[model samples]
Target: MALEYSDNMPHDEDDASDASSDVTELDANDFPDHFSEREGRLFHSHGSLPYPLPVDSPEQARLNNLHRILRDIVELHYLGPVAEVLCDVRGRQKRVLDLCTGTGSWPMDMARLFPGVKIYGLDIVPIATRRPERHVQFEIHDVTRRSRWNDGAMDFVHARSIDLAVTDYPKLLQEAARLLRPGGLFFSGEIGRYVDFAHGFSSDPAHQAPRAQRFFQVVNHSLQLRHLAPIADKIPSFIQLSRQFTVPTIQTFHIPIGDWHPNTVMRRIGKMYLNALKDFAESLKPMLRETGMTQHDIDNYVNGFIHDIEHVRGLVGVYHTAWARKL
Candidate 1:
């Protein structure tokens, strides 16, 4: 449930074709060299790329304190500690599949927290390293496919922000159910949609949040992928549909990307996100110039909204985390 893994990528055209292919047998040559790089700052492993993005980036490697804090919050809110979650398990060693393990943060943390567990992160890209204390493996496999994972084999199956890789929620859920051992846990955290600024936050003057909000709406509509929806709101219903698993306990919380209130943790996050957006706008200026907006217009639009949020607060995004045991 950390920010890094919770944010789903926009689905690309190539995703469908890639998902349809046999992922397990994919060769290293099929992907970029960096994706299959076996050595780095962290120890290397035979990890594969299961998704469409390059996993090895400076932005990914430099995880900040807030990321760790968010991870801890999700861990506490959902599964508690690894020992406590696994204590009820029937086995001495647990096999876990970290579905869509972006940057491998969750699996890495899991391995560090529970050395006895065998954790494997399956993604479109290799984002993790080998750990000495734990049998952690990173593989590039499209978990969206039906034949991807062994049925009833994993003690725990965890997926976060994997919606971009999966077009069908039911199929993904079914796959999760099938992969888990009897009575094993199925843990998921996802966002259904971005928050509507007008409903959630007051209008901002200096940082044209109003315009940015409108812009985001247009962008959201234009984008082919729409997994950013408020996924937490639907968890209860999704769990009810799973006959193989018991009703899942759901927890939803506002993860403010920047400081919304003057003194709130969200305000800081809001600023960071605002800056990130600004940086993104600058990067895309060349492509967006044809849209008729001047560079200043883009800057004002990006900065105005962020400044307004920092000063006025109120708008916040929701993240969901849930867990259910296989019956």
Candidate 2:
């Protein structure tokens, strides 16, 4: 899928037939192994990821679905002068790192794409695959803390959808700056909490989600309460503020929230995004419970959110991807 895929027929990459987005409905009293049940939802008891979502199989499905959606939107595993940087260099070892690598799918794909490159994926929980390619290393580490990699040791660093776990973008940028060599690139992509009818992302209420603006606000509030960053819209600014990189190139992807789009490919992306939204609403359970929401009321809110967003027309999420070269 490319920028010209607006009216194109849906391909396998853009379709949900892969079943990665087919989240299994769980029984009321069921709990998976090594997972803790909180307010009728499952959660990871491992190192703090500051995530309210379940770390179970279903949650992994949502993550995988989202990965595909974003890739289809951008038409690349990454954005930037990545080709020149990752292009095969004679007699030199190139390295890549993925932070908060849920399922380790990104790095895995990158390894296959660049067989000669060494890739490392770090996450709070173990990656889905116990055994990966020889040059690819998967490890358990909380990205919110410092990484073990030495200074200027990486050729590229990738962080996607980590706002749920990281509170400070500037601090994270500093870490990326430390890890990258001169001319190494840093790439980041994140979704904003606010959805609007127009691409301007206007502050005017008329341009916002017709029936779900309050929902976005409440979600942002909950994230702030946990000292988590809900939006990475200002990451390019943070990168510039750190003075560790050249001017960043920012790319925006208008992800539809429902099957309301006229374009066939966009509508397909919308349906997939809608599925992710439902699961995300479900993932809010544990956090909402901590905020004193009763299980009954929480369930009602989740159901209502799903209904509102599904019917809302022209509701589009703004996703920002920024990439820059280290100074």
Candidate 3:
């Protein structure tokens, strides 16, 4: 089934306002200041790449929403209604692990959808809310290190948007393979890179409005400096090279980065993406500064990027999902 979009649908401003207003302030007593000593923009306690983002209320809200948006895009375009196929294949008493599970929304939702499955969500920090679901558990663990789970303990090992967290992509895959039972599935989804805009306004890529090229250039540079894998573009090949898994299959989806699409669903998704990107760029300020990008220059780039996204059309980002079974 193809995903459909409608342009003439009614706008739900009330829902938008509710979502915007629902952000809860992080209580210091409850959340504890885990990042009190971090001087950089990225979280560094994990001894990995400095996670270039704050875990404050607003940032948490943005991440939660981005998680939902990405999940919707993947489910609609890639997995569709067949996410439960893994559950059926592995039987009802399934164990699932989600690495880099920011906000833990995906695993929680999966736990609800597959009530018989036990889902474990791991990340560098515990950002997931306490949910009533008994089968879903969230843990604070880094994916680059050895996991506490025993060998062949998982039925499905899932990862998403972990490009920034991993220093060794192949090693992480090896760990995942070790954790999965034979014939178990390993699935990953990631954005290949920043959005690529196709607009009629400019012929030069450098001169294009809402130019995000520089933003990503700084990001890539920082990741390279930190010796992190730029997994966005290299994820598929990494999966193919792993001897523990069968040949991987992939699905791709192009998400608009602005309200440029004629279809209402695409436009809505694009607008949400624009907001998410704005927050994402803001989070990169510290890393960009570390790269010696002046605050003035970064500000100019961010402003231009926002302008392009708001006024321009034809901007899109590619998201890819690759999956294979343990041999």
Candidate 4:
């Protein structure tokens, strides 16, 4: 979150005396962003995107790390056939919508790669960046409710890590359908809420992460209280049942949790993913408090989860990405 660029304009030597007259100097430690702090972490103060995580620099770094890992694994900004859809066949720039655009990395990347594509990032708070590149715009809105945007207004829609924020996943899909023109594309990717092991791994003494499991169990309970639950697996069914999309594709990638993977590259990926998860566990502390857990209990669970993810080489998680084209 270091200042992207100096906000104050430079003045000539003669005008140095007048610099402080009109321009207020910003303190080195000054954070202009407003947020609600909990457990020493800053969370978004408003909007319908009730994602229970910090909106500060550390959380943003974690999100960006996860984004980089996903991109490195898939080696692409998206999984579906979107390049053709993004082509300007209508004699106008193609429209792209991103839901819960955390860190706004994906849309920004798309904007840079496809200058002709219009990328709209929707979120409750604008934590992405102060300056947006051309063809990239950010919108503040509630994802739990229908958006004010018109029907069939986009050529493509993208959503990631929205399982916790959006209460009704199926309804969101229906909303995506409403906003996508005929033959438009929709894509979503989510990391599993709970940890799972790689093949031939189990909860036995040799491979179990008991504390980690308990932490996620608590998380599941917490989510239920908030009218949200991990529904990454139901994404395909939701898309199919809608009957508004065709050729729906579903894929799951195994993400290693630590540096235990035998493959050199995977080990690197695992270490990076684990580093990101450590930050993620910290961000969940405030929300976990609402589950009636004592401060000591929250600290213990979070610390344990971090330790397990860092030390348990067999620890793994699943990333599910689903995409389809509007019929």
- Judging by TM-score against the true structure, name the best candidate: 4
TM-score of 4: 0.85
Off by over 4 Å in 4: 1-34, 47-49, 203-207
Local accuracy by lDDT, each model: 0.53, 0.74, 0.68, 0.78
Better of 2 and 3 by TM-score: 2
Q: What's the candidate order when arranged by decreasing lDDT?
A: 4, 2, 3, 1
**1-327 in candidate 3: lDDT tens per residue?**
101111122333311121111223345553333443344333534444456566555567787878767766765422522364355543335678888877777887777778876777777665676552676666556688887666877778888888777778899999999988888888888886565754443444356643666666667777678776467667778888888888888787777787778878777888898898888878767767778878898898777777766676677777878888889
Which digits, one per residue and each the tens of the lDDT, describe model 1 over residues 193-285?
A: 454343445545224446546545533442333332324467657777868788788877665545544655555655655454444333334
Output the number of the lDDT-best candidate. 4
**Of the pair 1 and 3, which is ahead by TM-score?**
3
Rank the candidate models, highest TM-score first: 4, 2, 3, 1
- Runs in model 1 lying further than 4 Å from the true structure: 1-69, 75-85, 88-92, 130-133, 147-149, 196-208, 225-232, 260-311
Number of clashing pairs, model 2? 0
